[model samples]
Target: MAVLGLLAGCSGGVEGSPVAAERWDPCSITPEQIAATGLDPEYRDEGWGKGIEIPDWGRCVFHAPGGTAYPYGLDVTSSEKFTIADARGRDGNLSVRELQVGGRDAHMYKTETGKSVRDCSIALEVSTGVVVFTVVYHTVDGVDSCQVVLRHVNDLESAIPAGPK
Candidate 1:
């Protein structure tokens, strides 16, 4: 599946790459946004896309003190490929709901109920593709990844460069 995503992602060519977006800054998320997640927002991975075809659409994993690297990530890209179905009911998700973001069509979903959460994602409709915000956690951390998204989704939206609505 990973291989399929890589090749399929190339359909947009270089013009649709996240790095090509002028106002889209993946790291624009403020400290307050990370703090809302109750995780250590201080620790962050700085490298951009090292392998993904969508240049800047790399993963951002935030770590908590004494915690393993969670799969949580924030990706802002112009590649019009992924759909909300891709982010729903997967990755241990339990419930999914629509979101209201600056008049843009958006969706938010949470992982299945358990001792800890697997991850949560928000798919925001963009002019081209989607902006997926993900929060990953360990199996036993008892975390709610959606809480982070709900608290800071606005910040995520603001980072996107102005383009077709």
Candidate 2:
């Protein structure tokens, strides 16, 4: 009985552990930055919608210009509880590649349906956690989602706080 009790104690969960606060706010991206990415700031959606919230995450979605040739939306999510490794382990992520974006550790991943690339994301390492930029197309257009995501990352990389040296 003593040995069993010790084993159970070792398997106890870590409850009430505090997670680091997010270093960056997804909703804090300025309108000028949105315009630089060819997105309309007026169409930005906070938290994707009111009453929809993900614990430990800050999220915002920016829409492409109206009546564009290839319509799409960019969802920027920041989470102190998640890391680049967490993004790589996601079930639907494919072609996960580790790379450096503007001197910061980053991961690029995408989702595919048969031969079609559905969406792409770049997860950037930040001081407190990871900020993921995902570009999702509104239609089955031929535009490369990864390129679009990378462009946004480059444009906004300076805005994201750097991790520990």
Best prediction by lDDT = 2
Q: Please provide TM-scores, in order, for all candidate models, with all chains considered together.
A: 0.53, 0.79
Runs with alpha carbons beyond 4 Å of true place in candidate 2: 1-20, 67-70, 112-117
Q: Rate the local accuracy (lDDT) of all candidates.
A: 0.58, 0.82
Across 55-156, the per-residue lDDT of candidate 1 in tens digits comes to 534445555445455444443333345544555535765577887777777778765545454666677776645667766556455556677555556755
Candidate 1 regions with alpha-carbon error over 4 angstroms: 1-25, 28-42, 46-57, 64-80, 83-94, 111-117, 139-143, 162-164
- Which prediction has the highest TM-score against the true structure? 2
How well is each residue in 1-165 modelled by candidate 2, as lDDT tens digits? 999999998986888878757457887889998888788867777775667767778888888888555477888998888887788788987888888998888999987755543688999988788999999876676788888889988998887778646
The worst-scoring run of ten residues by lDDT in candidate 2 lies at 110-119
